[model samples]
Target chain A: MNREIVLSAFDIHRSYGSADASIQVLRGADITIKIGEVVAVTGPSGSGKSTLLHALGLLERPDRGKVLICGENGWALSSRKRAELRNRKIGFVFQFHHLLEEFTLKENVMMPCLIAGESSEEASGKADRLLERVGIIHRASHFPSRVSGGEKQRAAIARAIIMKPDIVLADEPTGNLDADTSAGVEKLIMELAEEGSRSFLLATHSQDLASAVHRRFSLGSGVLREVK
Target chain B: MKQKLLWALARRHVWSDANSTVVRMVSALSIAGVAIGVAALVILQAFMGGFTEAVATGLTAMNPPLHIYLPGGGHMDDFDLGAVQSIASEIPGITRVEGVLEKPAVVSGAPGTVSGAMVRGGNNAGLTIGMDLARELGVTAGDEIRIASTAGVEISGMGRVLVDTIVALAVDSVADFGLEEYNSSLVILPLNTARDIFRAHGELTSLGAFVEKGTDPVEASELLNSALYREYAGGGWPVYMSCIPFLAFHGNLFKALGLERAAMTIVLALITVVALLNLSSALTMIAMEHRRDIGVMRAMGLPPSGVFRISILRGFLLGGSGAVTGLAFSWISIFTINRYFPIKLDGTVYWIDVLPGVFPVTTALVVTLLTILVCLAVSTFPAFSALSRSPSEALRYE
Candidate 1:
């Protein structure tokens, strides 16, 4: 295979309300992503950056568009199939990590695999390996409440990759962390993308973070412009 | 595959979290409420069933379903000692017939103004009494007592001679009958004594018959009624008809409790509703608390139906546990009360000595069904809220 595109959104249109009070979130957005390619989306606030990320991640369906992931029509898919796609192919690491407060770090890391219907032993085994790779294995037993911010984000990253998703979607993943923790999480994110054989689509406000990725797309004036 | 995973995740969340525990606890309480209400109903209802059964069986065992006492009327023409016996024998289920004459009499320590006494003529030399009334009134067997009845007493106003002749006889048995109305007044004597002293000539006052076991009164009563009708026509006698079992013993005590039972069941079921409401609130709180986790599960491909199913399962689990606890409690209480302090009506008259409690298997099954229903109904609201929860909204809060 010649590294075919795993995610593509064509002329996507999304509006929040009826015609009179309508607030359009995505206006004819288009993007195609390939395997083993790290893509970063950078933009100022309110540029529909997160909305675009969500639409592409199968978390949000556009009002008008054909969203194809792994060459399957996702925008027209049933809620069941859409959810299946989200679970198996795409992993999300949010700005706040969004780790469940009640679960231990190990359980948190195993969430994606668990949701993918993997057995506890198998999920746990994968989660353990990922936690070790992300350097959060020592704190696997600690609940998210007890873990440090950096450790929590690492666990989130480990969780995102537990099922070995084809693509990782991170939106401002380091926004809530201090510089040192941000650097630590950034290293883990890069390591996950490389060692886990997964592509990353990162959306953030930091120029430094964008510069570190293999490619960057800056969202401005309702469009994604590739920046080499 | 996704549903199983979601359920596993949901179960873990349910098992390992305080909010989840509270949710399930509320459900358990609802189930318990159901179980408690149902068990209480079963226990209480069974008491009635047992009581009515004991009463009916006890009464039926002694004679026919009922005893027909012809107070003033002379002996039934077709109801000869042999005629009554023959009619009864003609029917397959008619077991025994004992023809007897009962008369009221006076046995007084004083003249004229005499205490009450009854002179009954039959083979029955000994009779029992209810314990409570016996203890209340101080009278015993072998004691000289007074009995009086104007069985043939004539009313001066109506010019009617409706009173059966009254006489007294030496009574037997201790003051064991608890009924105040029957205590120390019954005088058992021979038929000749009853007829001669009470002025009952060839006129018989009553005919009693016992029916075979396992024979329903309706069928036997119909059969007996036909035979009596035929006998009346053949002998040219005026025989007014009334079935004893139908008249005297219909287990009206249980019938009387019908409204009370329905009202109690409705009232107690309200407790289950309240518990269900409590469960709903608890489940709602839990659902809200786990919004982000639910979002995660949704993201992990859990269908909305799966979420709803898991909520229902949790409710059922809680309800089942509560039902077990409540059923245990009710069973203990009912079994204990029925076992030790059994209500014993006077056997001689009412046909039973000890009140009985019957636990039917149907009752247990019904309680379980009601528990599940109440719990699951309450759980749906929270599950709906969970289904509508958005991953974006949940993660925003997160």
Candidate 2:
């Protein structure tokens, strides 16, 4: 049976700098994500993998073409509406863990729920449950500065899926971790994706991570092509 | 919900130790600057307000509220004291009206101790001289002083001659009127004696009307003038009667005081503005330092407006803290000075023996609100500058 499409991007184009000195980053990068699908985009450094993830996640507006999250055209919406869409339906996990250092691990995980207007009690409860699921419940009260790299990454994963988004876009999710920690984070991501029928699109350089995903795509010279 | 979220984020940013040492130091300095500015403004305004009140009380206490007289210094030969008293009684604020004959006189006490004085003769018995006049004449309350009125003149055997109407009267009491002009040259005596000395019987220079406390003297004067005109309509009186409020007597002095108050307020407000500029700089530094955190918030779906609100709230927190601290400081300072260490002044020179500090509540409220408004206004530029960068741009380096 075919799963429902959760996120899709068609012929997306993006560039940097002014017109005279602009360098195009993404050109005709197409992607489609279905529920319960763990997909990886494999590329060399500066190959526009992060750019494609940013466009698909609605974090950046594409210069041309369309990005649809749950059938709503994200770029076509107003900036506020696009933010609402991103908050409600899309989650992001960056390579650096990107947890606010001022907050505890549990508070970091509860941030999205709080942003969605959930009460503190409700958000706290959900955050604890997610922390337990990610196998970092013991470190839930620790600040990001005090946590290990692998534990920080687990908290980041918990935060990304706390809102129960249709898709999670991770750019180099475990790029800074050791081999054992990277494998642990990869196992946690795969387990979470399967448990909740959640889709994940990861931009990574690790062939091991790419091979673990259900599908893989290689981006080169501003173009993305699927590798079976 | 959104406001709560914004407040939470702004509050965390303010209390967070994640900021650089330079940023924290700058923030503390900004708060201190605002506190000093607000304290200075409150204390200065309180003291100035107290001084103005003291001056007003001194002037009003020595003089009657309303002075009813004829135009051009013309005396009323047929001045009916009973009729004017009856009319004044009918007015709500007018407590009493007394006929007065005032004239410049040359007074001498002891040998060659002579000075020019304004002799005001009313119904009060005995001769009352100001402290300064008593000192100058070398006379005590019981010493006799000789006076010759400038208005007293007579036709003698020689054509068109001045009359020497010198009469010696013992000083009843020496008093201080709290003003240099009054204390140095004022003398008070009985109406009958003044009439005999000036040789002008049944004549009154003006009708002095006293009003009840808390009554507006100017409005009462206007009401009295209207009533007097209505009573003396159609040539009932020889000339038109006019009422002058006590404030009108020292209009220029009061106007100058008011202008000084306004100028002082503006000059002090500039200090607060300078402090707010420091606050603006501090907020800008915080925004720059927290760029990456702002990007993380944006990635979590916070809009540009949310970022702006967070910055504004941060400014408000800082400004409000400073304002409150300043107000508390001023209150303590004023209370301590007033209660334990009052600043003494020379009564003869400054009128009052002690300089007073009166806290003005309305002024404090206005200053606090304006400071907060300025904080919000100054934070906007930095907030918008933060907004100019996209989330991806902010997160690019991280």
Scored by TM-score, the top model is 2
What's candidate 1's i-RMS value?
A: 2.6
Stretches of candidate 2 off by over 4 Å are A1-3, B74-95, B101-205, B212-214, B226-233, B236-241
Worst 10 residues of 2 chain B by lDDT: B11-20
Docking class of 2: medium
- Output the lDDT of residue A18, model 2: 100
TM-score of chain A of 2: 0.96
Worst-scoring 10-residue span by lDDT in model 1 chain A: A1-10
TM-score (all chains, Cα) for each model: 0.79, 0.85
Q: After superposition, how far is residue B100 of candidate 1 from its true place, in Å?
A: 5.5
Error of 1 at A76 (Å): 2.5
Candidate 2, residues B1-398: lDDT per residue as tens digits? Answer: 35887887776676566655676687778888888888889998888898778778778777777888777767865455677787779999889998888889899997889999998888777888888889999999899999998777766788777877898888999998766667788898898898888888999888889988889988899888887787888457653778899778878977887899889888988998899998988888777777788888888888878888888888887888788788888889989999999989876677677888999788888887888888888888878888888888788744
lDDT per residue (tens digit) for residues A99-157 in model 2: 88778999999988888788999999999999999899999888888889999999999
Least lDDT summed over 10 consecutive residues: which range in candidate 2 chain A? A1-10
lDDT of 2 at B72: 70
